[model samples]
Target: MSGAAIALEGVARTFPGGAQAVRPCALVVPQGEILGLLGPSGCGKTTLLRLIAGLERPDPGGRVLFDGRDVTRLPVEARHVGMVFQSYALFPNMTVAGNVGYGLRVRGVRRAEIAARVEEVLALCDASALASRRVDQLSGGQRQRVALARAVAVRPRVLLLDEPLSALDAALRERLRDELATLLRRFAITAVFVTHDQAEALAIADRVAVMRAGRIVQADTPRALYAAPADAWVARFVGGAADLGGVVSDGSLLLPGGRLPAPGPHAPRARFLVRPGGLDLADRSEATLVGAVTRATFLGDRLRVEIDGAAEGALVVDAAPDAAAAPGARVGLRLRPGGLIVVPEAEEAP
Candidate 1:
């Protein structure tokens, strides 16, 4: 089955006690596009995903449409959407093949057809060898593949996954992030996933929607979102290491620490974000910002240098692995051409 574009028009969810878990918002997911709902805890990303899956209903006047056809009132089963929960939720006693075919069986598919579909999905997920093995006998990675196979075995119109990789250890999760992205593209199915990890969201999804306090603050491609964040919080949350704010005059930000050649619209006062790799340690005579190195750690390929008295608190910068950086050493830093990002003033800036 082909993918369907999804639309949420003024969709919001309010719990019984009048707590608005999700504020009214409109978002569109293009056909076959993988959209990531990204935010911190209690940002309503999970609730929004539930509304799209038909697992939760929206408040009155909200609408959920698949390819412009309304499906707001339909339950999950009728909506023909597949879900993979954070737990993997596989039946411990069931074999891989059995688990993958469970959805087909629920829909009264014939035994022969169910077996054929299960085999196809298991191969797609690279778990064909585990077909006869019980889910409980599989490793964490194996379990995840089986869960994904089960969800896609029936070829649902849309696939919803809630933290599908959160169960794995750090190394395993990093290894599987790319695999999941490849699998989604191969499936070519409309999919929406919930994730709080920014790196995962950027690497896996075609676009990311950043949520805050039950509202969708911004939605854009990973590159656009990083290069041009809508505000200070988004900048800090994405990739920025420090926030520096002061009056900008003649293309320079006059901070207490020093002057930074920040190019942005002239404002009486402005704030700039220094992304971690955006600052380079330079000679004292040519440096724009100066500080004392508080801590330095060699991060395999490069050196992570944390400096104090730069802007406010510690500002981290990426230096060459062999660079001379040690605690208590004074250092001068120069901003790269695209190093600083100018953002609108907000209380979130520190």
Candidate 2:
């Protein structure tokens, strides 16, 4: 099925007691694009999804549009959208085929057509072999497939997934993430999925919207977002980057150990952000910073070395497995070009 473009204009949500869950925000998802709403718990990612699905109404002057048509006031049934919750929500008494065919039946579609569509979606989701099994008898992965098949059986204009893979174990979730991405691409449906896992969001979505406190901090492709985060919070949240507290002086970041060249001219009090991969071991004569190795961990293909006295606190670095570094060993650190990012220091929360 073809996808539809979704647009939200000035959308906001508030609880009955006047607690605002979502601040007014505008967003757009192009047709056939899978946009990942990524954030921590209570960041309003799910609330934004519910607003799009018509499960929750927006505040006054907010509007939702699909394919340039207004759908702001439509109920879930009339919106023609598909949704998959984290729980799967499959009926215990239903067979796989029965669950897949439920939506078509609700629409009063002809039985023969419903059967054909059910077969097609089951095949698409690689669940054809499980058609005869009861919902209670299927595995977590199989159940997830059945849920997705049911959602798509109605040929929805848009698909919304709320942590669809969260119900499975870690190994199973990792394996199914690739499969889910392939299935979404095959269907070519406009989809929005909410996820707290940074790797999951980066792996599956064409674009990611990083939300915080009910606001979108940055929206960009996975590579761009990782390469250049919008701020210190985004750098830490998206890439686990370390914040190096320092002052900028003469185009260099003055740290406790030594100075590293800064990106561009900024205020003297600007803090800096650096990814773990940005620091590398170098000879003492050529090093930009110096610190003592506090810990070294073997992570299959690489070594993670933790250093002390680098900046305000300890800093971690991704190093080669063959590097001869150990705990309590002194090492010189070189900041690669484009490695140090100047970011505004986080404001103190009132």
Candidates' RMSD to native: 1.9, 1.8
Q: Pick the candidate with the highest lDDT.
A: 2
Question: Clashes in model 1: which pairs?
Answer: none
Alpha-carbon runs more than 4 Å astray in model 1: 267-269, 346-350
What do the candidate models score in CA lDDT, each in turn? Answer: 0.89, 0.90
lDDT of 1: 0.89
Model 2: per-residue lDDT, tens digit, 157-203? 99999998999999999999999999999989999999999999999
- Return the TM-score for each candidate structure: 0.95, 0.95
- Cα lDDT of model 1 by residue, 45-88, tens digit: 99999999999999999999999999999998899888888999
Q: What is the lDDT of residue 290 in candidate 2?
A: 88
Model 2 local distance difference test score: 0.90
